[model samples]
Target: MVVRIFGISIVVTVISLVVAYLYGGVEALILCAILGIFEVSLSFDNAVINATVLRRMSEFWQKMFLTIGILIAVFGMRLVFPLAVVWITAGLNPVKALDVALNPPADGGEFFPDGSPSYETALTAAHPQIASFGGMFLMMLFLNFIFSQREITWLSWLERPLGRAGKLDQLAVVVASISLIVAAEFLTDEANRSTVLLAGLLGIVTYIAVDGLGSMFEVDEDDIDEAAASSGGGPSQLAVVTGKAGFFLFLYLEVLDASFSFDGVIGAFAITSDPIIIALGLGFIGAMFVRSITIFLVRKGTLDDYVYLEHGAHWAIGALAVILLVSLKWHVNEIITGLIGVVLIAAAFISSLVRNKRLAPEADAEVEKSTPVS
Candidate 1:
């Protein structure tokens, strides 16, 4: 498996290099490598969650995710998303925006010559919007996890009386939409407010629509059990359920990844405006790392060993979501957003290790008791 994985990586690397060479030579290669490292380091949490999900997927879907999913991530989110933002905000034609990104205006010691702003300046300029997007996105993810994990008791209706409404999802959608509209109306300069509002609405609406669609297609646990019993296999009914569960898991993983990439892609304006570079560099490298991490988690059964890693990643994602929302009003640095996630997850991992160590003696004693005295 290691050899196969390495071989696959080599093929991917060679292909990426060839594309980079044709497009921007050494510059593209260097950028891709850097972005790859950045994405991998910041997204370790993503891998853990992805592993948990991937393990549940059918082999067919797993292959699809590895192939089609990678393309969507690389081209759709990383490349097109940023260019779309520029086009929407700056009113630049898509082709021209692509050109400007590829060949930015000369630097005048103030900003890029094509009237494009510097990385820091652009990030500062758009900071509020980025924050709002990230914050709300993460918050929704956090809430979803919390609600899902809670024990649902049919008779315990003490907390909030609206449980029978079946409208929490709708409420979420409406609130997010109104929030964006209101923010656009009052929170920003007239020229830029429309852009920010539209972006926020886009994120919220997109998430809701996608999630809803996924739910519609989801196979229930009972259904999975029936299917498994019908076919008598060593994997068992529970295994089938877990495999089907992977689909939703993969969907959530993709959504989470998309949310994380939003800021990073926007942040790339700080490095270069060329959409090609942003797409080629960040997209290629980031996708590769995501894949590598996914494979690692799947193979090592890391989730079984460290139960809290997913919790930590989700929490980090939640923090990011909140940061994005707050950023709508106040500027938050992407570097800071990335760092906060890394630190939180790293702390969780260390804590998990410590807990495991402390439990070692107890676990060993239990094993000894179960064994015949020798």
Candidate 2:
């Protein structure tokens, strides 16, 4: 099972590194390795969150996610995304955009390089809109999770109050709207303010549409009974869905992937502007690990075992959203962004170990009681 899950990622890693070394010698190989490390470190939370969704999907959909979805994640975001940004911002056609991205001009200024704005510059120019969109989309996810009813709480002192406050109608929307407004009003310059606001509103709308539609169309499929039993169910951890409902859920995952990629790709550029190198590192290596990790977690039931892992991942998401919004005005180090998730997740993992230990004796006693005079 482990080999089945991670085989592609391992294959991708070796091939990508070989390609990287060939493309730019040992230096590129080293940089590619570093970027791969960065992406995995920064997006471990992504795996945890993705596992939550993957478990709810059917076997067919899950396979598609790991296969077709991996392709989309690798090439779509890593290759096409930056190219599209450059195409639009640099006034180049698609072909021209690809060409320019592949061959950045040698005119050496900062990002622009004393020449017409390079692909890197165009991408940087588009950051405010990108950040606003991705940040709000992510913020909505975090807010929705944090403000909902859950069986467990990792940080009771904090989550308890937030959950209580969530009782109000549309509180998540209200909070997310206020956050968008705050980012626009204080963070963005007047010239970009309207664009930022529009992007954020679109983010919110996209979330509502995808999530709401998925929920509305979901019906208990034939296999839901098995899913429910396996989950030891109160209403089932897995929602059996097919057709449009399933498609919407799939769409939600992709959009969520895009939101995460906005930063991950940018961080890759910070190391080197070569699109091919970025693809080798961030796409093939890093993204492969992320998806494989999601599969591993689902199969191993790791999230269920480590109860607070989901909570920590969501909190890290919340922090990332804040950082994105803050970065609209000021610089936030990518290392700091990556470390935030790592630290929160680590703390949560340790806390879960402690919690399991505390419950062990009680569980043993209950088992003894149930055993009776056997």
Best by lDDT: 2
Q: What C-alpha lDDT, on a 0 to 100 scale, does residue 51 get in candidate 2?
A: 92
lDDT of each: 0.65, 0.89
Q: Pick the candidate with the highest TM-score.
A: 2
Q: Which digits, one per residue and each the tens of the lDDT, describe model 1 over residues 81-158?
A: 666656655666788656655554465343565566433343346555655565556555555554442343221353
* TM-score, predicted candidate 2 vs. hidden true structure: 0.93
The C-alpha TM-scores of every prediction are 0.74, 0.93
RMSD of 2: 4.1
lDDT of 2 by residue, 78-157 (tens): 99889989998888899978877877776544444435577787899999999999999999999999888777999999
Residue 29 CA displacement from its true place in model 1, Å: 3.9
Q: What is the lDDT of residue 85 in candidate 1?
A: 59
